[model samples]
Target: MTDTHTPRGLAETYFLCWRRRDFTDLAPHLADEVAFDGPLASVRGREDCLEGLVGLARATTHLEVERRLVDENDVMTWFSLGVGGSEPTPVVNWCHVEDGRIRAIRVAFDPRGILAAG
Candidate 1:
């Protein structure tokens, strides 16, 4: 429920890509030096971020969005992540937008379930 011109909308687009398991459109939305911090790793720069995300996404079976909160250039999206057909793990991604691109993203989630499943 976001217009394509807004930050939330960009995130929604990313989520759509996640649902479809395609990230071909993701790189342009991220800043050249975007930062990504997650339970497993912290990566800087857009290439590394995209690489890490795609690498982890390979194990995903599904992504179900629960909610998204937007405050100016900041957006937080809550979703359920299904890995290897296992029970979904709740995940929250805090995204910071700058210059019409995603500058940073910090993800929060319990890795126990995902790690144990592997």
Candidate 2:
């Protein structure tokens, strides 16, 4: 499904595409000048964000959403990620929406939990 241009819609689309590792589906939900800030690095622009997300998808396995909260143009999602047979690591991502697409995203989590496993 395409992004619905709503805060909740954007969050759902993100997690859906992320779970499937479907960058194609995730692309349209990001604004042209989207920015992503994470524990590892920061990137700006849609292409750059997509590249980073794709690399992250490859490095990890079994991405799952554990909890989520949406308010207007902001969304917070709690996630679980794991590699191989290891335990899932907790991750929290905050997304800011603008013009029906995600304009910015900041993720917080224990880097050692998933980075080393990946």
Candidate 3:
């Protein structure tokens, strides 16, 4: 696992954790007061975000990161999330990192694809 102390490294590690379904590795990357503004729901706190991520992992079959952009403490990742055997759903996440952990995450995507697949 890459160092989560830096923005780019943290972003990479976060995606890697998701791809591997390693929520234990994922948890430490989040700050205690972390907030997540997801495509389907918005939440605050690390534990709540972790719970939400668990649901996302169950719904997603795979995730492929297509692109990444990092500038200082801000990181943006563009990826495709696969649901079952259906086509991959496109997603973008903007992350804010501070003090070696994620403070907030804002995700953009259409849930119609996953919903339709279900």
Candidate 4:
């Protein structure tokens, strides 16, 4: 869906798209060139982002978004991740948006947290 909200609102929409695993909704919000940095990998371009997210969604289950904070061009979201029937691990995602699309994304989470819980 098209975003008519302020920068922060646009950021929220992006997260909502992720929650639903709706890449179509997410794709339009990304520029032709985008960048993603996460615990697992770093990717660039809208196509790569789409591919990575699809793979991520397939590998993750029971994902839940908890907290969201947006200011200026930055958006931070905290979430719980469940994979392979394991307990949820806390993850923090930080994103930067420009012209209504994501310019950069950085995700931080404890790898040991997942291993410990398992």
Index of the highest-TM-score prediction: 1
Model 2 scores a TM of 0.89
| lDDT of each residue in 13-114, candidate 2, tens digit only | 887777677789778878999999988889999999999887777766678888899888899999887755457878899999988789999998787865
* lDDT agreement of model 1 with the native: 0.86
Tell me which of candidates 1 and 3 scores higher on TM-score. 1
Instruction: Report residue 41 deviation for candidate 1 (angstroms).
Output: 1.2
lDDT, candidate 3, equals 0.87
Model 2: worst 10 consecutive residues (lDDT sum):
109-118
Clashes of each: 0, 0, 0, 0
* TM-score for all models, in order of appearance: 0.92, 0.89, 0.92, 0.83
Instruction: Give the 10-residue window scoring lowest on summed lDDT in candidate 1.
Output: 1-10
Candidates by lDDT, descending order: 3, 1, 2, 4
* Each prediction's whole-model lDDT (CA): 0.86, 0.83, 0.87, 0.77
**Residue-level lDDT tens digits of model 3 in 1-118:** 8877689988888888777766898788899999999767999999999898877777678799999999899999999988766679899999999888999999998988777778
Model 2 CA lDDT for position 32: 97
Model 4 misplaced stretches (Cα beyond 4 Å)? 1-4, 113-118
List model 1 lDDT by residue over 78-109, tens digit each: 99998875789999999999988999999999
Clashing pairs in 1: none
Question: What TM-score quantifies how close candidate 1 is to the native fold?
Answer: 0.92
- The alpha-carbon RMSD values of the candidates against the true structure, listed in the order shown, are 1.7, 1.7, 1.3, 2.4
Q: Give the TM-score of candidate 3.
A: 0.92
